[model samples]
Target: MFEYQNNNYENRNQMYDYYQMPETGGPACNRPSGPKKTGKAGKLVKKIGAITLSAALFGSVAAGSFQAVNTLIGPTETSDNTAATENTSASLLKAAAIPGAASEKGSLDVSDIAETVMPSIVSITNKSVQEIQNYFSMFGYGGQTIPQETESRGSGIIIGKNDTELLIVTNNHVIENADTLSAGFIDNQVYEANVKGTDPANDLAVIAVPLESISADTMSQIAVASIGDSDSLKVGEQVVAIGNALGYGQSVTTGIVSATNRTMGSNTQVVNTSADGSALPTYIQTDAAINPGNSGGALVNMKGEVIGINSAKMASTEVEGMGYAIPMSRVSDIIETLMNETTRTKVSADQKSSIGISGLTVNESVNSIYGIPSGVYVASVTPGSGADKAGIKKGYVITGFDGKTITQIQELTELLQYYPAGETVEITVKIPATGGTYTEKTLSVTLGAAENSNNTQTESGQQEDKNNSIY
Candidate 1:
């Protein structure tokens, strides 16, 4: 039950850590079959029991549950017979030692790792409870309208210092649409939190909470986790995962570095266009078991340092061990910005200009062979829109925006975030079909306010001033 507000800060510190083996004993034994021999005497009896026992023992060994057996047999007349029996006895002994051999090997202490990393893992709950409204019907019948309240829960990583204030890193969706935000520490201390900054296009968010109530002694116990270079991580390296699994408190899981430089589709949107959707650059994929509440948790290396923030788990009936995390290399810049800035500020919607376009960058082949420019190309134009009204032609290739050269779709999206809607600016575009013309266009068209698919203003958009800004 952490309580948080917009203001108040101090220093605090915190610290905190799946494969299936085949069944060892089952009906999967493969053994040779043979008939039992009968004695020559009239009263001779067949010995099928000995063959059955031997088959069962062989099956147990193959299934990984071998047991040692000592048997006394009559000495054979030939020396070769004795040698064969000795070899068979030695083989049985080795088979029976399989389980013990495994037991002798030591495994990593996951609990110790969990204890070291648990302080940095936080459980986040985002709630959007709406106020109820009541209305009377025309027929004098009373009715109640219960506004729906939405809440989401996820995990976060502690990246900020503990002495002056506590800062957390999590996915933007964890706090997106949340009217109330709170975080619970592994020590059972809950604190109200505030959104410091968020980049939905990257699916990353920075949050902060006051450390006023944190005890002085326990504060020193807080340890700042070291950030490792994700670039250095290699495939097949051992890694660990720590998070609030399924909202059931702090949990730790381990696996190897399943892969690196994995690409994931952007859960965040840009300009309401899937064409312009931005994804996190170079994800770190792991086989660690990450669940619903594990989003925003830490994917740590063997040194117990964080390399990535666990974000998503693959959903499939056939796949049971795939999870994805945002690489820390890409998140360091965003986290640093949030720490330096107190409030999460953005260019007001009305004051923003320049619609961002994505996915039109020319490939190397197109640039080298076909002589196509390698920059973001405008796909289409909105009717009566700012760019359209300003004579900025559709299908024009944008070379630069606001003095920044654009190479990828992310570059355009990032630049647009710096300015608010309704703010007009000049743009440089290369018109390929216009006789190889490169034109500079100055457009003063007022930017239009953003609306969701439901035709309602976005939560962030609602904060804009419609009168002075765009309509």
Candidate 2:
């Protein structure tokens, strides 16, 4: 579970609840709030203040720095350039001065590591239209949803380059609901971005920028980040964080490995838990400052290799320096899935169906302890969808659907892939009882048409409408 820190924590909670509302209490939409097992694993993650830079490294700058020299004369055009050039020779010289510099060493120059990783890092700005409802408007019956354009800032790492596009990986939360995305380079160049793919379960997303939008000179200077083995990380090892700290350009923070394989709990709103009850995404805990806008930044080791992606941090009056990141090892496959371009394509009306439900696979341990079988737990049912019309109730665990053995929400998603919109399918569910007994029931459900084109499974079994027209 990711911890969000803020003073307006209660207001954020209210906003989160409001996000699940359908414009007119339509039957097709499932409210975000639903009855479920509640457990407090850690403090609630809330708002991170503005201007705070959250990175792993505490010492100085990204890549290298150039000293600006002024000639005693007033500012005027001259044959000599005032700004100095990068000193590659100094890196060599510094490396040479260090003991065993020619071979693998425990530490490398922090500035050099930042300099090397900085070009690969870019700041991202997300602009989305947030439509809020004014229930108190004219006679109360004339309430309407008001659309407001909002802007958010975060950081991303250039991971791959194709002939036509440059791809960067970042937290899904960074670009969620974004109507327009822009990527900014250290040179102050910005490029319009397109959503390549996203997996909110892990809070990961892949955004692509047109290579043609970048200048030839700047493109030549940009480098793809070198990915490292997060499994190889050891506690107490030094690491650095670089990101658009607190929405103000990219900044760096330094710290050591405070802990590893840490589990704050599962964020059911985003993270997908394992069906087998193993392998919850563990975090690399550090003491670095993880402020606002650091959500999608990189956490690199001293060797100038990115081992983790900065995700969340613990912020409170009683807490200090408890930052967290997702291990890079666990991110590779999800990123590759999002990078494939076609994974997030718009769905044709005949290609997909929506059941009007929002649910997720339950935690294995919780299910077992509660005497409930491990399966997809329905959080809420859409008012008049196939599931609701079939008398399917929330809190029921789905064991099978259309003859497919469904033990997890992911399986249910795969099963739905074989069906088309406006198709009727049989659903099998197991109802729980007070005495640890379950009754199996079969129901016929006619799936509804998914809204718009970008119809994809968001959570395990949840199909979130991408079209913002309905607010």
Candidate 3:
């Protein structure tokens, strides 16, 4: 089974191929009904016409599927009528194209699509440091941790660029905890990349590579992907997936839209409601093979327009060809926001800011048990600190920091690593309302210097320090 951050991905059954043809003739304002004939011969002629139209429409979809199969395997000879049938099918396919969506509603050549779209796709490499505790510490020896560097691979789509950076979009998990990020472009050259911004709740992130780092040759070789309307997507429509599958560089896989508007958790499991406080995200389910390294890849239509971002795949011994993607139409605005966020670097420990609050993580379980808001439950706010000065009370739950949503004290702590001392940020809190209810309030707080960073307390009243502390 393919595993991405140990999450289980899911997908459901597909839908029908073609749409029902309209019986009415032309526009309603100038509509005209065809002359009716009562004779049995006339009825027989109408039946034959209906069958011919259905055959042509069905033949269009069948031809596309056959081409997909042929693209997978070697080609085989077809009957002489195939040419004429395909010509008729093409006309019907065009007539059936969804009105609002720009469609390539005809025979598809997988190789042509791959050649056109691969330049906009890139392979991502994330290098991060993980701490591993010594096993000897369990046997009475002093506990010590070792820093280990790890590398992982994923894929990304080149969306756009700014004055100094080339912006690429990918799944947040692909670059999570990344100490150093790199993008390998179509030119076979790798360049350093920085996280522009991240929406962890949606599992989306935009990374930027400096224009100066990329060679002109590479710049000429790569292209920005053409974005398509996911809202216009129809079930069973053929789509192509391009990604750095298994970290073997970009590869192409073909499939059909199995389903849409499938609500899912950030972990990729099918869920009606998010277990976390964040909003539940929806995905486009397809039969495409989205592998481990395929996370953050492109799911494009036959026109080579990106309609979805390939994120996860359902891998099971009992099921096959089920994958999920974040629909492009749903997150277009989010991507813009991420792209506009100021690129930041982790502040040094000495220069970092502290919110000066002792808080405990309150998740869905805590909310259900205590009837409190799901966020960082502030047990104490230090006097004269930024949080306290901003009118943050002891019982208030910190729900958001700057623009990022916070469900746990650890999230707040992690975010504090980027904002330096004296930088003012907006913090959203849930204040205690009448009858144990909570009302969200946004407060502007100037972060304080980390002078007492080592003297934080956990929920159990245990003394903790930064880097090793839970809060």
Candidate 4:
């Protein structure tokens, strides 16, 4: 059984409920009545006089103290006590050590960056409501059904701009099956967006909105961020992140480029799990503080160019600050394909013949338990699959597939995708012999489609199933 822990689910549900409620002031504002006077005139007069005298004395003392303080320090040079003295000393030391510290020599003005890039950082609000049906028996004979809703918020960056249309790039999971989507700009203008295309395998999506819907001034000032080469980034290079932090607004956070060319997953299974579960990339690691809403935002270089798209964070209960991004180099390819409408091209027939298999390498612990070598092991075979009909044993250990030596699941998938379908291929397997050692045998089999399982069956001279199980 698979376990799920989605913190955003509850928050989104709460947000939907709050949006449905009407504003009202009930128990929040209430006051008590003032005390009533019920005393003789003479006694009340005396009490009033005493209170007035006390107030006058306090006011005179407060005025005199203020005058004394102001007299000691003139208006031009106001009194700055011990705290200010310590601050002045610290500033003097800092100024003496660094010649250009006080001057804005190397720093770029924030106002300039905001004025240029803020229009490109779009606020994305994706609303997806799963209708939860609740049936309750009313009295005895009838039942009532209740429908609940949930919604979520995320951010995206404007990566494409034509003369008439603007494209916003965001995570596929952000807009996946969304019922409604809205894009907001820095000018406080919101526009309903349309999903242009999505590549769930890559965890990326390109959304579009009409240019006329947004503010004319904002559209004119919008700058399509210049894409930078993520390959050229180093471990210690400076980087900046501009994103909608926690849905508050566009925020800027700075850090150094922690690492690059980092591989997070190895095979197709690994890629599928990571991309499908968390919507993460295969490479590009950074140290930036990438929060929830920062997904699909821009990971910019010091030159104000976007180098990557902020994707995920790797933090535990005990650690923090490890984040990852999809390199802009890969993003560029996806965007270009979407813009050209070439993403729908099908894989070649030759590439589809070689079905990828993974999770074969037995670890030390598994070796001790299974009494097998620490190599790729064929755990199971798809029924009527290419390998199945080829007389390849299910429990038989696979030493290699094609010509490449496989160690992980991802390696197998990548290699298989390179080949086409309906091609005869050879597979090497290790069979348990009379002795403790295994004997290697080569078998030739006609490949079948990856999606069709009924085409594969036990070949002649292969061991048949002991039971009458169709699988």
Candidate 5:
């Protein structure tokens, strides 16, 4: 729960429904039955004439008064001119004294930034399946689970391109659990995209589109955005946000940096903190109107350089004009790592691999209550399975997989979608040691087929359930 302006508000980052078709049925336009009478027009013309005559009479009186005053004052042109010059000079000095006051850069023209950055921003569409629970079960009938296809829209920035693929960086939640993805470029052309890699801790991901799939015209039109140093950003510095707002086409919004190094504590979207303990996964707080579809868009500086990536915004009935973006400098290295990762396509359900284990997520509460390390606590291991053969025992906590950090079962499950069965990978686990401490050990495990990934039982002869089980 997020609060704003002394009022309770939630930090909302949900996606807007994209690709909704327009409805054709509506009321038809009705034209006037007949032309209006000339009576009103004639009266309006007569009123204008009378007003003009009155204006001429007032002007004559004002001129006569001016002439009388001039004769009485006896020619004071030099004094009036001198006073005007002094006043103008004083105003100029005052303006110069203040920072960013009435100067060339003070009043920015965002049109130029929009023009340069629009080509780098793209509209992303995610097609995924969501489970819908049945309402009829309340009447004693068995509930049926239904899978519904959903389409969501987000924005991405073109970071760079290799010989084979064009890489775009976006928020991880935008493409999470996506069955298919497509990017709409500035040239109005859409291309298929696949996730290259993701860092869920930072809520960032890099997606790649094949260069050969894009048309030459679109390739010529799209460009990589210039990256700017977010560390150099100052409060009240003017910035522009460009994105596909509300699932519409590319649009631009301008605002100043309300504050820097904003840490929205306990917000689910931002969970990590700096290694030096200086700040939490900090955000660039701005007053720009970042709508639902603006997630993963670019927060650009006046020089048409990208300084931050639009991620989340605070929403409330009593609040307005507060949005947040992830600073670019903080995640530059992570983005580069994701870009260089091997691009993988989602494996089919039948071919997906699984490590034979049922585990519980060791979240903050569990870690605190049990005095155990934060990771997945293995409840049971299937007999003769890959995990069992690899010396994985019950009561051990799995911490890392193939050099990637894992803290929950869902993260492991999502990662298994790319690695098929029989693929050998390293699995790191924390073994319970003396003094109630844990020792880290890495083991090579060959993944088994999904059919044999069910947990059997623990050594204590207790029946193990498949709650929160993952492959």
Candidate 6:
């Protein structure tokens, strides 16, 4: 068994990856299948042959055993598909740091910019079949997770289009864990979408919808939004925000850049750290009216170029005029990384095995005061997960996986890299009885699929329609 070790550091700032978790709580309603509003680029063209990108597709499974869906496939090296929009985004990000480099500065005609970019914007609707556990299932009673339907609204921007598919970018939360995804265009038309790649921790994802979904004329009408240089932005600069406000039709909000390089404390976010070791995310703070369903929308400059992605806002009785957007400079690499994705080796939710517990990373104070080890402190468990089947429950502290010592969530994730679905392994957990004493136990757990491991967390995150505001 791996043992917990004690080490100390001072003033280490924990930078949670910055992502505004969009709220989903509200009355469920059918998303309007509006008429397809054609854009300059989405107009019909010659029908191209289909392109099939398949990952680790699981074959037939035997009785009583589950396999994880395909794991993500990516290139060992970068693809050479350099389009103009991609180059423009790179140039814009550079302009911020180069003294003489800047997009034509000055106030721009908001109307002209809005019209040019609006065609790239789209409304996203997610349809899901969730399993709801009845009362008996709640307390270890005979509760089975039943299928329930839920729908949510958000927005996306058309970034690039290939011969066969139109690639769009949006927040991962909008399409995450959904059974079906659809994109509604300005013209009263909606088409099925498939996930090309997603980075949930970064709150970024790319989805592909077939070109055949729209007529050649409609395809010609759609335009690809030009990514602008966020680094070139000055505080107090004018910007425009557009989104499917309140699940209604597209609405526009105008404001100035409020601040730059801002940070906020929130629930655990999965983000990358800078080489210098900062945990904070960069943002272009603005006063734009970024409301619900705007999480993945655009924040553009006067030139009508996208410089940032509208993400979060300060919501409180006491706070106002504060909203945050991920700077385009910081996101260029992330978006490119996602676009390069080609396959998924992991299984989907239903077929995978998992330890079944959700947890929080314990900090030093808790460890020093309560003697609780610094590791993943279990908060809950999925009823049907491998950890649950092994009798694991909430409040158990997982200290080790296999033979590796783990003291943090990152370590556990790294250790998990070695194990896969349908595989059995030994895990060390600390369980305490009612009297406040602890016992260490080793359990033989057959690991569930990875996709299944994320289901409970996704379901819990989507449970309430409350907290459904921007970020």
Global lDDT of each candidate: 0.62, 0.69, 0.78, 0.61, 0.79, 0.66
* lDDT tens readout by residue for model 6, 1-471: 122122333323333332232335664234358765356433331111111111112112311122121111112112323353466456545322223333333234556667667788888998877688876787997757878899988888888877778888888777766667888777747888877776544567888887877787667777788888788888878788987777886778888888888765444232221111114466778888887788778898866788987777766657666777878888798887766654223345355445666676666667767867656677766666788798877778887776434455655653453346787888888887666667888888888776666645545432322322110
lDDT of 3 by residue, 1-471 (tens): 232121233423333344344445554233248886669977887788779778867866777776576654433234434664677555435423222322232434567668878999999999988898788877879789888899999999999999999999999889877878999999789999988998767778999999998999999999888888899988878888999999999999888889999875545543111224545677899988888899999998866688999988765566687888999999999999999999876777678788777778887767878898878887776666787789987789998887887776756776777689889999999999899888989999988887753343333343433444322
Residue 460 lDDT in model 5?
A: 29
Question: Which pairs in model 3 have colliding backbones?
Answer: none
RMSD of each: 20.0, 32.1, 16.9, 22.6, 21.7, 32.8
Compared with the true structure, what per-residue lDDT tens digits does model 4 show for residues 1-471? Answer: 111111222111111111122335575234357665457965876687779668766766766676676555554343434555566455434322222232222323334444455667888887755544355445454555555565666678888766656888887667764667888887777888877666555667788887777676877766566667788888777677788878888887767677886656423222111342223355566666788778878887644567888877764665556677788886687776655431112246433654423235565566667676544566556555667678776566665555333333444444454345676666677777765677888777566666453244333334444332112
At residue 349, candidate 1 shows an lDDT of 47
TM-score of 5: 0.73
- What is candidate 6's local distance difference test score? 0.66
Q: Lowest-lDDT window of 10 residues in candidate 1?
A: 65-74
Compared with the true structure, model 2 gives a TM-score of 0.56
TM-score sort, best first: 5, 3, 2, 6, 1, 4
TM-score of 4: 0.47
Of candidate 2, the 10-residue stretch with the lowest lDDT total is 11-20
TM-score of 6: 0.54
| Residue-pair clash count for candidate 3 | 0
Measured by TM-score, how close is model 3 to the native structure? 0.72
Candidates arranged by lDDT, highest first: 5, 3, 2, 6, 1, 4
The parts of candidate 5 lying over 4 Å away from their true place are 1-108, 138-140, 267-279, 455-463
lDDT of 5 by residue, 413-444 (tens): 88888888999999999999988999999999
Point to the candidate with the largest lDDT.
Answer: 5
Q: Which stretches of candidate 2 lie over 4 Å from their true place?
A: 1-106, 135-143, 266-279, 341-471
